[model samples]
Structures are given as C-alpha cells and as structure tokens.
Target: MYESFYGFTSKPFQLNPDPSFYYGSRGHRRAMAYLEYGLHQSEGFIVITGDVGAGKTTLVRSLLQRLDSSKVVAAHLVSTQIDADDILRLVAAAFGLPAKNVEKADLLLQLETFLVKLTAAGKRALLIVDEAQNLTPRAVEELRMLSNFQLEDHALLQSFLVGQPEFRQTMQSEHMQQLRQRVIASYHLGPLDLAETRAYVEHRLGCVGWKGDPRIEASAFDVIHAASGGIPRRINTLCDRVLLAGFLSEKHGLTASDVDNVVTEMREESGPERSVTPINAMPGLDSSALARLMADPAAARRLAEVAAGYQASRLEARVEQLEKVICALLGLGANTTDGADQDKERRHAG
Candidate 1:
C-alpha cells in the first residue's frame, strides 16, 4: 500500500530474502569472504553461524546468485530434526534424485553416482544445510561422511552449514570433532551496527526507487535500530509498519514518534492475553459470514480487486500532486521570461 504512495516499483521491506536486496555490512562481507575462500578450496565444511534474522539466508542467496550454474551444482535444505537416514534422503531429493523408500546403502550409492556425474561434467556440487541446529548428532555425522566423497585427490562434494548461534555450540560437542576437523573456514555473522543499520535501510529503499518520499528523519533511524536491535528482519517489520502508519496519517515525512507509536501498538497486540475482545473481531462479523467469505472464490477475487483499486487511487493522487508541482514550476519560469521581455520592450521604447 505504501509502495505506491512512495513511488516504489516493489515492496522493499518484504520479509522474504531476495539476493538482489542483499546489503554487505561488515559482518556479512567477512562471511562472504570466508565463503569465497571455501569455494576456492572446493572441499571441507564451511560453517556460518549467526543469531536469528541475522541475514544468513540472504547471504547464501547472494552467494548463489554469483555462482555459475554450469560450473556449480548447488542444493539447499532446511533441517527438520530428521534422523541420519532421513537427512541423506533429503540431500538426495535436494539434488533432484528420487529417494522414496530407498535403503540407506542405495541412497549413499545414488548420491555418490550423482556427484561423480556432476564432477565428470566439470561441475562441483555444493550442499547448503540451513537450520543446522535442528540436526541431531547423527544427521550432522552423515553430512560429514558425505564430505568424504571424492574423485582421486579432488573432493566431489563441498558442504556449507548455516544455522543459529546454538549451532556453534553444537559443533563444539565431542561427537562433532570429525566435522570440526573438516571445517576449512567459519564465520559468525553479527547484527548490523548503527551506521550499517542506516545504510541497510537506505539500500533497500533505494532498490525500489525511493526518492525521499515520506522522508525519514535521522532520529527515526536511531529509533528503528533500538527497537529492532539492528536485525534485518526486525528492521523490515518495523519499517513496513511505520510506512503504513505514515500512509494512514497522510504524512510526507516520518519522525521517531511515528516509529514509537507503531512499536507500541505492535507490542500491545502481541502482549499477554487479555479478557477484552480483540479489536478486529467486529461485533457484526458472524461466523457464517466469515465462513462464506472464506469459501467463496468470488469473494476473495472481489477483496483482491478492492485492495488493488485502493492502491491505484493512492498512486493516482501522488502522480497528480507531482504533475501539479511540475506545471507550477514551469509556469513560474514562463512568467519570469515574460517579465524580462516586457522590461526589454520598455527600454527599447524609451
């Protein structure tokens, strides 16, 4: 909604990780450098640990974007507390192989064959496992074993492990000694600092063609960093809500107070359970009416159309304002030229 009002081509503060919007803060840059070093070695495990919402996934996406698909075959998996055998199957599936009901031996054989084929085609295989903290010791061991697969002296498969900070603790366990031995590079991604936080917000907004509409005050940035603790996802959530608030209030500039209001509202909504009725639970909203809306396809379509129409109207208003400003400036220039011409004529007559 605010995207149109702010003249953005796309939603900049979206939650999903998009490689195109990656911001290379100090920590992220060091992480990327370690990842690049891992790629150059082309063997062993590269462990990247970070706090929740520290942009680990975004960093991985950015790395994948820079890779040459023809030379690199990459597979990604988010761990689900699966056992060792299940993890092997998941890896096989990530590589586009059928793993259903396959025996453990067969799964390993299939994976080896696939990796060998990729190697023969002059492509290296990169396996990225996210949420590694959820993986049991056995599952992690399976990954370590897979890293042992090689052709002659060159390793066929390289693994990159990404997870929350607890994963670093997991790696220190006695059971993880072998896996630790295979790690060639490791880095801990940290939250953005104050300066980086400001840069990060500007970078994302700039990506969507933000031209300072709903201009944000410097103090607002400080408030956002304080509220979000410099976490990328938290910052996105706060900024998105703040922008919505600005739109509703018809504000062309945002202050720290705007951010504080939104943060307070969000906290209240997420606070402890209360006896009072929820604000969204309108008195007239009957169960039947809600069920009908949910069941009816046409109702959903109409709701979408209504939303689109509202956004279109907002964009139209903004465009009209811009046009008016441009025309006024042009008229002023014309008046100045006419005044100069009149003065010249008076001088000639004299």
Candidate 2:
C-alpha cells in the first residue's frame, strides 16, 4: 500500500528473498565466496548454516542466477523427513527422473545412468538441498553414498546443503564421520550490524528508485536497528510498518519519535487483530492527529459542529415520533365523540 505512496516501482521490504535485491555485506561476501569455490571444485558437500531469515536462501538464489546451466544441470531440493530410501527417490524426482512406483534398485540405476549421460555429454549434475536439518542421519548417509557415484575418477554429483543452525549439530554426530570427511566447505551466516542494517535498508529502497520523498531521519535508522536487532527480516518488517504509518499521516518526512509511535502501536496491537489504519481512514486526518486536532481551535470547532449535527439529527427523530403519537391520540378522541353522537341520535329517534 505504501509503495504507491512512496512512488516505488516495487515493494522494497518484502519477506521473500529476491536475488535482484541481494546486498553483499561482509559475511555474505565470504559465504558467497565459499559457495562459488564449492561450485568450482564440483565435488563433496557444501554445508551452509544460519538462523532463520539470515539470508541463507538469498545466497543460494544469487548463486543460481550466476550459474552456467550449460555445463551444470542443477537440481534444487527442499529436504523433508523421508527415510534413507525415500531420499534417493526425492533426488531422482528433482532431476526430472521417474521416482514414483519404481523399485529402489531400478530407481538407483536410472539416476546413475542419467548422471553418466550428463558426464559423457561434458556436463555435471549439481544438487542443492534446502532445509536439510530435517533430514535423518540415514537420509544424510544416503546423500553421501550418492556422492560416491564416480565416472572415471570424477564425481558425478556435487551437493550443497542449506539449513538452520541445528544442522551443524546434526553434522557433529559420531555417525556422520564419513560425511564430515567429505565436506569441502561450511559457513554460518549471521545478522547485520547497525551500520550494515542502515546500508541494507537504503540498498533495497534504492532498488525501487527511491528518491527520498518520505525522507527518513538518521535517528529513525537507529531506532529500527535497535528494535529489529539488525536482523534483515526484522528490519524489513519494522521499516515496512513505519512507511505505512508515515503514508497514512501524509508525512513528507519521518522522525525518530514517529518511529517510536509506530513501534508502540505495534506492541499495543498484540491485544487484538488490528490494522494499522482503519478502513475509513480519511485524508488530511489520521489516528495520530486526533489529539492535535482536538487542541487546534479550528479543528476543534469542526469537530464540535459534527457532534452538534449528530445531536440535531437525534432531536429531529424524537420530534417526529412525538408528532406521530399526538396524531394517534387525537384520532382516538374523535372516534369516541362520534360514537357518543350516534348513541344520542338513536335515543332521540326512539
């Protein structure tokens, strides 16, 4: 909603990771270097671990954007809790091979043949397993066994494992010795610092052609960094809210106190499911303007006029109801008089 107000061509703070808006912080650069190095080596496992929303998937997306699909047939898999045997089927399916209703031996043979064909054609197979922390030890071991596929001393498939921090613990298991020995590179992604947080926000805004219509004060960035703890996702969430608040208020620029008000409103909204601005939000007036409007003489008089109009409507309705009651009472009295007059005329005739 605020995107239009800010004249942005696109939403700058969306939660979905878009490699187009990928910002290279210090840590991300190092992690990307490792991933690139792994791609070059074309063997063994490349493990990447990070907290949720720490740009892990963004890194992968960025890498894929730069990949040479002619030489490498890449398959991306989001890991599930399937068993050892099922993992092989999943891998096959990812590479466009038939996985359903096929026997395990046949499935393995088909995958091996596909890889061998790719190798003979002067191509390689690359697999990226996402959310790999969910994989059981047996499932992981199966991945390692697939790495054993060899074509004349050259590995057939190279795998990249991306998961949350818990995957590191999974790799530490004693049963994982064989897999550990085969790991070519591993890196843990961390959150941005305050300086990087500011840079990231600006980078995303710049992506959408930000011209500073709603100029953000420097102190506002500080508030955002502190509230979001320098996490990319959290910063996105808070900054999006702040922009909306500013747009609703018709603000040309935002201040630190404005950010604080938005933060407090977010906290207060925990009670009920509420929207930032009500559906009937009006131009030149917003929720935050109530106090100021009440203080100003002109605005106060306008409000008083509105209140007076409402009271006048109620009074007019009451008067109309009283008039109807009076008419009903007058009609009953006339009917009684007519009945008496008729009875007297009958007596005289008798």
Prediction-by-prediction clash tally:
0, 0
The estimated TM-scores of all candidates read 0.77, 0.75
Kindly report which residue pairs in candidate 1 clash with one another: none
User: Residue 204's C-alpha lDDT in candidate 1?
Assistant: 96
lDDT of 1 by residue, 315-335 (tens): 334323322333343334766
lDDT of each: 0.77, 0.75
Lowest lDDT 10-mer window, candidate 2?
Answer: 275-284
Task: For residues 119-227, write the lDDT of model 2, one tens digit per residue.
Answer: 9999989999999999999999999999999999999999999999999999999999999999999999876765677799999999999998789886666556545
Segments in model 1 whose C-alpha atoms lie over 4 Å from true places:
272-350
The TM-score of candidate 1 is 0.77
